[model samples]
Target: MSKKLRVAVIGCGAIAQRRHIPEYEVNENVELVAFADPVNERAQLYADKHNAKAYMDYEELLKEVEVDAVSVCTPNALHAPVAIAAAKAGAHVLVEKPMAVSTEEGTAMIEAARQNGVQLMVAHNQRYMPPHVKAKEILDSGRLGKVITFRTAFGHPGPEGWSVDGRNSWFFRKPEASMGAMGDLGVHKSDLIRHLLSDEVSEVGAFVGTIHKEGTDVDDNATCILRMRSGAIGTLTASWTYYKGGDNSTIIWCENGVLKIDTDPVDNVIVELTNGNVERYQVGAMATNEQQTHSGVVDAFVTHILEGTTPLVSGEEGLKSLQVILGAFESQATGKNVKLD
Candidate 1:
C-alpha cells in the first residue's frame, strides 16, 4: 500500500471543522496529523476527536510538525501569510477562497509556493459541485453556443448564524474579514463564473454597501456588472439579508438557449432552447451550510499533491478572482467602470 500524505489544518474555525477536517478524515490518501488554532480548546477538541496533535499557534505547529500538506483555513487577513509560511515550510497549501485581501499578498503566496516547488490551491469548491461540473461540460460541447450574458447570486441570512463565533464572528469585522458579503460570498460566484464560461472578467461597475447589518462596517450587499473577456456581460450579487434563507443560483443566456442552474427546485440544470425544445437535468441540489457535503476540494488537493500535478484552482487562478472583486470595490468607490489588466 502507498503511504498516505500527512496533513495539518490551521484555524479550527467553522470552515475547518465543517469541511476541511471532515473531508480530510475520509480521504484515503491523507492522514490528518495536527490541528492548530488561536484557541487552545478548539484545537484540542478536534485533535482529540481525530487522534492528532493540537497547538494554539500555527507557527509553532509548522516548526515542529513535518507534514506533506497543510490547509490554511484562517481568516481573510491571514490567508496569504499562513499559506506563504506553509509553502516555505515544505508543505503544499490549500487556502480558502478570495486567496487574500490584496493582489500583492496573493502574488507573494504564489511566488513563495513557486520558489519552494510546492503546490498552492484555493478552496473554491463551487467549481467542483456536480451541477457546475455538468454545466461546464454542456458549455464546452457548444450546445449553449456563445454565452451572451449571465446572472449569478449568492446570499444567506449572514455568517452570524453559521460562524463558530455567531453574532460576534470575525466575518462581520473589517480588520479580519476585509469585506463582508462581497468577500464571504461574492468571490465564490466570481470564481464559479470564470470556470463555467472559461473566461475572465475584464471590467467591473458596482454598488457595495452596508445595508443589512448593524454595527458592521463591511459591506452586507453588493451588486456588480461584469464585462467578460469574451464580450459577455453579466451581473453578480452577494448579500447577507436573505432572511428567508440562502439562494445560490446562476442563469446563463446563450445564442441558442438559456441555462438555468440551481434555480428551479425540481431540477438542477435546465435548458430552454430558442426553438421549442427544453432539457432538464437532475444533477442533485447544491450544497448548503446546513446540509454540508464533500466539496471535493480536499480530495482534489490531495490528488494533485500525490500525483505531482497542478491543482485546478491554482493560486494564480484564485488571484484573478480576487482581483475582480477588488476591482468591483474600486468601481464602487469611483462610481464608474474599472478595467482589469
Candidate 2:
C-alpha cells in the first residue's frame, strides 16, 4: 500500500479540535503528523491525543514537520496568510469556509497556491452534503427548468452559549472574524445558493445588525437579496437567535416546479410540482457531525493529492462565496444594493 499522506492541522481551536484532527485520525489514507495553536496547552493536548508533534507557533510547526498538506482552521483574518505560507512551503492547503474576510485576501491565497503549484481546496462541506449533491444533480438535469428564484436560510441559537470559552468568543468579534451570522452561517447559504443555481451573484441588497448579540461588535442576524448573473433572484438569511433547532434550508422556484434543499439533519430535500405533487429526497452518506464532515473533506483532500485530481471545492469557488459575504456587508453599510461585475 502507498504510504499515508502526512497532514498538519493549524489552529487547534474548537473547529480544529472538534473536526479536523479527529477526521485525520480516522482516515486511513492520511496521517495527522503535526498540530499548532497560539495556545501551547491546546496544541499540546491535540498533539498528545493524536500522537503528533505540537508547536505554539504555526511557522515553527511548518518548518519542523514534514507535512504533505495543512488544514487552515484558524481565525477569519489569519486564513490567507496561513494558507499562503502552507502553499509556499510546498504543501497543499484545505482552508475552512469563507476563505477570508475580504476578496483581496482570498485572491492572495488563491494566487499563492497557483504560483506555488499546490492544490488549494476550501472546506465548503455543505456542498458535499447528500441533499446539496442531489440538488445539484436536479439542477444540472434541468428538472428545475430555468431557475427563476431561490430562498435560502440557516440559523442557530448563537455561539455564545456553545463556545468553550464564552469570554473569548471569536464569532462576536468583528476584527478577529467579520460579521456574525453572515460570516458564520450566511456564507454557507450563499455558497449553497451559488452551488445549486450554477450561477454567480450579480448584486446584493442586505440588512445586517446586532439585534440579539447583546454586547458584540458583529451582527447576530442578516438577510441579503441576490441577483444572479443568469437573471435569477434569490434571498438568503443567516441568524443566530432562532427559536428552534438550527436550520439550513433552501427553496428554489423554477419554471416547472419548486425544489427544496433543506439541509436540516432530518429532512434534506423536498420537491413540489405545479400539479400539486411532491417528492422527498433523503441524501445521506457523509456524516453530519463536524468531525465526520471534516473526514469527508480530508478524504477528498488526500485523494486529490495522491490521485492527481482537482479539489471538489476549489479556492476560487471559496473566493466567490466570500465576495457574496463581503458584498452583503457593503450593502448593509451603504443601505444600497451592491453590484458585482
Candidate 3:
C-alpha cells in the first residue's frame, strides 16, 4: 500500500475539531501530523487528542514539521496568508470557504499555490452531497430545459448559538470577519446555485438588514437577485433569524419542471413536471465534516494529493461563488444592481 499522506491542520477551532481532524483521522490516505492555533491551549488540546504536534505560531509548525498538505482553518482574514505560507512550505492547501475577505486575497492564495506547484482547494462541500449530485445530474440531463430561475437559501438561529462560545465569538466582530449572513450562510447558497446551474452570476441586486441580535455589527439577514451570464435569473436569501429552523432549501424552475429540496440535506425531495407529474426521493442526511457540510471534501483532497487527481472544489470555483456573495454585498451598499466584471 502507498504511504499515508502527512496532513497538518492550522487553526484548531470548532471547525477543525468538529470536522477536519475527525475526517482526516478516518481517511486511509491521510495521517494527521501537526496542528496550529493562536490559542495555545486549544492547540495543545487538539494535539493531545489527535497525537499530533501543536504550535501557537503556524510558521513555527511549518518550519519544524514536514507535511504533505495543510488545512487553513483560520479566520477569514488569515486565510490568504496562511494558505500562501503553507504553499511556500511545500504543502497542498485546503482553505475554509468564503476564500478570503476580498478578491485580491483570494487571487493571492491561488497564485501562491500555482507558483509553488501545489494544489489549493476551497472547502465548498455542498457540491459533494448526494442530493446535490442527483440535482446536478438532473439539471444537466436537460430535464430542466434552460433553467430560468434558481433560488437557494441556508440559514439558522446564528453561529453564536452554535459556536463553542456564545456572544464572544469572532463571528460577530467585523474586524475578525466581514458581512455576517453574507459570509456565514450566504456563501453556501451562492456556491450551490452556481454549481447547480453551472453558470456565472453576472449581476446582483441586494438588501441586507440587521433586524435582530442587538449590538451585533453585522447584518443578520440578506436577500438578493441575480442575473446569470447565461441569461438565467435567480434569487438568494440568507438569514440567521429563522428561530423555527427549517432553512437550507432550494427551488429551481425550468421549462420542463420544478425541483425542490427541503431544508434538511437528508430528507424527501420533491419534483414536479410540467405534464402534471410529480415524484419524491427520500435521501438520508449526509455527514458533511463538523457542520454537516462536507466530509467528502476532505476525502477528495486526500485522494487528489495521493493519486494526482483534480480537486473537487478548486480555488477558482470558490472565487466564482465568492463573487456572487461579494456582489450581493456591493448591491446592498449601493442600492443598485452591481455588475460582475
Name the best candidate (by lDDT). 1
Cα displacement (angstroms), candidate 2, residue 307, comes to: 1.8
In candidate 1, what are the lDDT values of residues 1-20, reduced to their tens digit? 38989999999999998999
Per-prediction RMSD in angstroms? Answer: 0.9, 2.1, 1.9
RMSD of 3: 1.9
Residue-wise C-alpha lDDT for candidate 2, range 1-341, written one tens digit per residue: 47888899998777776777777788888878898888789888878877989898889888888888999988787888999999999999999877888888889998999999999999887787777788889889996689898888888788766555554777677788776788788998788788888799999999998886677878889988999999999889999888576677788999989887764455577778888888877776434322244446777887898887888789988889888989999998998999977
Quote the lDDT for 299 in model 2: 75
Compose the digit string of candidate 3's lDDT tens values, residues 1-341: 46878999998877887888888888877888898988888888878886889899999999999999999988777888999999999999999988888899899988999999999999887787777777787888897698878788877888777666567877788888776878877888888888888888899999988889788888899999989888989889989888775477788999999988774444546778999998777764533223464458888888787777778688888888898888888887888899996
Residue 171 shift from truth in candidate 1, angstroms? 0.5
TM of each candidate vs. truth: 0.99, 0.94, 0.95
* Stronger candidate by TM-score (1 vs 2): 1
Clash count, one per candidate = 0, 0, 3
Q: For candidate 1, what is the TM-score? A: 0.99
Model 2 residue runs over 4 Å out of place are 263-267, 285-295
As a TM-score, model 2 comes out at 0.94
Poorly placed runs, candidate 1 (over 4 Å):
none
